[model samples]
Target: MSPRPPRRLPLGTATSIGAAVLAFTAITVAGLGSFGAFSGLTSARLAMLAAPEAVEVEATLARVGITAETLAAAGCSSGDATNVGADALAHLDTTNWNALVSADGDVRDAQAEVDRLGKLVRAGQADQEDLTAYATAKSTLATETSTRDGLLDALYDAAVADLTSGETTLLETMHGNSDRPVPLQYTVSDRTDAQWTSLRNALANIKTSGMCGEDPDTACTTLVTNCNAETEVATAASNLDSNLAGVTSALHTALGQE
Candidate 1:
C-alpha cells in the first residue's frame, strides 16, 4: 500500500502554528526597531544633559585665564603703599580723654576747674597763688592732651602699617598663584580667597570712630570680591576634566555600547 500520504496536520493546528511564527517574526523586527529608536533618544538626552555643563566648563576656563591675567596686571608686589593715607585714617584711635577719670574726676571736670580758676583770676577774685595754680593746671592739661594725641597717632600709624603689610602679602601671593598650572592655580585661588575673606571680615568689623566712616577701604573690598569671583571660576574650571568624563560615561551607558 502506498505509504499513507503523510498525515496532514489538522487545518486548525496548521493555521495556529503559522500565526505564531508570523507573530514572533514581527515581534523580533519591531523590538529591533524600538531598540534603535530608544538608543537615538538616549543619545539626544545625553547631549542635552551635557550641553549646559560643557558651556559652563568652557566659560569657567576662560574666566580662569582672565582672572589670572587680571591678578598679574594688578601690580602685585610686597610692600605696596597704595592706601597708606586712607588706612591711617581708617585706623585712627579717637579715644575720648574727657571721658576718662583718674582720682580727680574726669578730664572734663579738670577742664571746667581750669576755666573757673581763670574766670576768678580775670575777675580779680583770686590771689597770686591761686592764679599761679590755675596757670600750671592749664599748662598740664595742654601737655596731657598733646601726649594723648601723639600716642593715638602712633597707634594709628602702626595699625596702618600692619594693614599695608597684610595687603602686600596677599598681592604677592596672588601674583605667585597667577602663574601656576591651571589646577594648582585653582587650589591656590581657593586658599587665597579664604584669606581675603578673613581679611575683609576683619576690616569690615572694625569699629572706627566714624571719622572715615565704618566701611572698609574700597580697594580692599574690591580685592576680596574679585578674589572670591575667581575662586568661583576655579571651582568650575578645576572640575572640567572630571565633568567631561562623567558626561562621556553617561552618554556611553545611554547608547548601550562603550
Candidate 2:
C-alpha cells in the first residue's frame, strides 16, 4: 500500500515558523522536545519556499520578455535585452524576495501590454501594406498582455499555496525528519534550472511561432536572449558566493543554465 500523505499549514494562517523557532528554542532549553514548537515541518516546506522564488522567476521572465518586446514594439533590431535583465536585478530571490510579491495590478498590467505588442511586432504579425491588420494586431496584443499581467497580480502570493494547498490532515505525527536547513543554494539552483527550462521553451516557441523577428534560425541563437537572462540571474545568485559554494561543488559553475 502507498504511504499516507503529509499535512501543511494554510495561507493567511498562523504558521510564523520564525516565532515557532524561538518558542521551540525555549522549550528545548526547558528540557522539552524538539517537535513541539517547530511542528509539522516536512519535505513539503521546500515547495513553500520555492513558490516565492518561482514568483520571482515569473517576474524576471516577464521583464526579459518585456524588454525584447519593447524593442520589437519600437521596431528596432537589436538583441540588447539588457534593460530587461537590469529591471530584474531589483527583485531577485537572491536577496529578500518576499518584498517583490506585493506588486500592484497596474504595473503588471502595463508589462503585460508590452509583452503582447512585442509578440506581434516580433512575429511580423503587422504588415506595412495592411494598416488595418497591423492596427488590429497591435491593439489585440496590448490587451492580451494587460490581462496576463492582471492575472499574475492576483496569484502573486499563491506561493504559500504549497503551505497546504495540496494537503489536508487533522493529525500530523512526525514519522521521520531531518533538522537540516533546506540548502538555499540548492533551491536557488533548482529555480535556476526551472527558469532555464522555461527559457528554452520560450526560445523554441519564439522561433517556431515566428515571434522573434527575422533571424538565421539556429538553436543557440534562438536561446541567445535567454542565455543572457540565465547568466544575469546566476550572477545575482553567485553574489552570495559563500552561502552557496560550500553547499555543493556544482554551485561553482553555471552549467546547463542556458
Candidate 3:
C-alpha cells in the first residue's frame, strides 16, 4: 500500500506559518525593516504605500483627459485625427452653410415681392406707399443678411484658429519640442515594461526556508511544505503592490512630474 499522506496542521498553526512566510518575504524583498515604520509590517502592508502616489498621478493626468486607447486610435505620431479642435471646424462649416442658404432664400423672396410691387406702381395699379414698403423690407433683409454673414465669418475664423492651436500643441507635445507635457501613450509603455520586470525580479528573489532539524517529525515536514506554498501567495501580493507602484510612476512620468 502507498504511504499515508502527511496530516495537515491545525488551522491556527497553519495561519501562523502562512503569516510568518509572508512577513519574511516582505522583509526580504522590500528591505522595509530599514525604514523603521515598515520594520514590523504584516503581509503586503507595503502595498498601501503606493496609494498617495497613485492619487497624485491621477490628478496630474486629469488635465488632458486622454487615455492610452484614445492615443492609439488618434495616431499622434502620424498626425491622424490628432487635432482635437478640428471637429469644431466641420460643425461651424455646416452651420454657416445652412445659415447662408436660409438667408439667401429670405433675400430672394423679399426681392421678388419688391419687384412685383414696383411693376404694379409703374402701371398705377398700386399705391407708391406699398412699393416703398416692399423696397424698404428688401433693404432691411439685405442688411440683416450681411450682418449674419459677418458673424458666421467670425465664427469660422475662430474655429480655424482653435484648430491651428490644437495642432501646434499636439506637434510640440509629441516631439517634446518645448515645455509641453508628453503624451500619455509615449511615456507609459516603457514604464509598464519596467514595472513587470521589477515584479518578476521580486518574485524570483523570493527565498523560502523551513525551520526543520535532522530527524524532523512528519508534522514538521508537512508544516514546512504547506508554509512553502505561502510563498506563491506572498509573491502574488508583492506583484499587486509592485503593479500599483509601477502605474503610479508611469503616470507621474506622463505628467512630467520627474
TM-score versus the correct structure, for each prediction: 0.24, 0.21, 0.25
Could you give candidate 1's per-residue lDDT for residues 97-168 as a string of tens digits? 111112112334556878989999889899988988898879876765555434433433432364434333
What TM-score should be assigned to candidate 1? 0.24
Tell me the tens digit of each residue's lDDT in model 3 across 154-243. Answer: 433332243344433432242231112322223222224444454334333332222332354455455434433554334333433434
The worst-scoring run of ten residues by lDDT in candidate 1 lies at 95-104
Off by over 4 Å in 3: 1-88, 93-100, 121-126, 162-258
Candidate 2 steric clashes:
1
For model 3, what is the error of residue 196's alpha carbon versus the real structure, in angstroms, after optimal superposition? 72
Residue 42 error for model 3, in Å?
A: 76
Question: Model 3, 16: alpha-carbon shift in Å?
Answer: 83
In order of listing, the candidates' clash counts read 0, 1, 0
Error of 1 at 26 (Å): 94
Q: Please, what are the lDDT tens digits per residue for candidate 2 over residues 133-208?
A: 5566556656654554443332322321222311111001111111112211112222344554655565565566
Candidate 1 regions exceeding 4 Å error are 1-106, 162-258
